[model samples]
Target: MTTGRLLIVMNAGAGHSQAEASRAAIRAVLDAHGRAYQFFLADSGSALPQQAALAVQQALAEGGAVIAAGGDGTLNTVAQAVLPHSLPFGVLPLGTFNYFARAHGMPEDIKAATEALLSARIQPVQVGLLNERIFLVNASLGLYPTLLEDREAYKAQYGRSRLVALWAGLVTLWRARGRLRIVLEHDGQRSKLRTSMLFVGNNALQLAQLGLPSAQQVEQGALAALALRRTGLFTVLLLLLRGAIGQLHTADKVLHFTFQRISVRPRLPYGRRRIKVATDGEVGWMSSPLVFAVAPQPLLLLCPATMETPA
Candidate 1:
């Protein structure tokens, strides 16, 4: 049970049309649990990271836990605040894809998640950093980030759905051109490669799909990196075929590896020393050369008492 007041920072746009209903359900569950908590509904138009940071500061001052009530992106914003202070954090998975919540063994249903939070146990979970920005899932450069950019626009115009996302990916792949030249340094080794895509995995499920053995234990304080080794049209087609058949890791043109930290630099740098990067489905620009590392201190995530950390 929450020993002190719990601060909840909710994103107004997270649940879309059902945002209100979700909020009511959360309130009812918390009240039934007799938890002392305060609510802060983040303005949809305001900068979420800033708003969440302020809310986190308030929660720390009140000597309580902070709960992020929304999808992975919303959780990421709240995490930015909690991480600096090394505060305990909770999550309410009210999103289309509850990747981070599911990774932590959080139930999808709101009432169930609430109950889990009430009798929660704190676990230190690893988080990945891109130029020091925390990301709970994966980060990517090249074709994948390009696909994310397309998917966001498509979702805006046609609404979000699995079918819509697939359509967006196809459209993006058809239009993508050329290869990326990057210098990647892992451990004490460094190499220059030309490829169409690169992905750094922090989520176990995604890593498993890429056939990495480390997917079984994501919190082992490491990262799985995947890169397409060839950029030719035929190589791209072969990678797509292998991916469709669940043989991506076995494909000759794909490189899959694990690391505790890595750095990436683009051959053609952007002005102002910045480069485009995507993490946990959110895209932004960060200063180059992008350095990714596993945080030294794991995040204190509140999970169900019965939940076991994934192995």
Candidate 2:
């Protein structure tokens, strides 16, 4: 959409050989289309913010757009850097599920996705902010973070795929036994509750696929929270099946709500201050009283014109 040029950032953490293969494939598509672009290869997670910030600065100065060319985590990295600049941002879906990209009609096929990026229009799309970080898909606390941690480990050992991800999740759930005692505050109301997983969703498509109630409210500027009640192992397995088949709405034990802003504070007796959190599948520790809210300014994204809700 920005006719100036393009700055594409690739998540090169997947290993040098594999990353280069994907890079070459993407380069072929862009070259065949005669698009003007440059690449920023992120060899490590810790360096992404610094590298992406440099790329974003250069793109902004050149009146061009910046593109995130991998999965949700990669997008999260590039987005954090670009959001501060207020320039048009783009995505090249290369991640499993591709939730954020698919919700905006981004094609999953490489050639199709490349073509869409070439002629996409600048559109303002809403995103969730986990404290000071940007999460385009979702953010969560409790068991979900553990699941992401295990998933990455499995990917390291068994390779990346849907089956491996599912296996990792099942293992985590089977071993999951802890309950979070927290004070949840939202909508000027507060409550104390115990739960295994506390998930806050921002992407309508992902929530809709999970058969969560009020999934569409996310597009209406509200986030949906799902709290899993502590249950027997068999019941938890049943819940997983339901979620997989888009029947989670039938689970009576799950608590669901919609809100504009929410705060979570862990009530630990030992004065523990940090808790593990997952934003768009990346897990890390953050101070308690985590705040999840819609960003005051929407992200300026490049998407095909056929999208229904581009602002």
**Highest lDDT, which number?**
2
Using TM-score as the measure, which candidate wins?
Answer: 2
Candidate 1, residue 193: Cα displacement in angstroms equals 0.6
Model 2 C-alpha lDDT per residue in residues 83-111, reported as the tens digit of each score: 87798999988888899899999998866
Every candidate's lDDT:
0.80, 0.86
Worst 10 residues of 1 by lDDT: 267-276
Query: Candidate 1 clash total?
Result: 0
87-193, model 1: which lDDT tens digit per residue? 88999998667888997889989888987898898887888888888888888887888888899799889976778987888888788885888899887889999
Model 2: pairs clashing at backbone N, Cα or C within 3 Å: none
Q: What are the models' TM-scores?
A: 0.92, 0.96
Kindly report which residue stretches of model 1 are placed more than 4 angstroms away from their true locations once superposed: 232-246, 269-272
Off by over 4 Å in 2: none
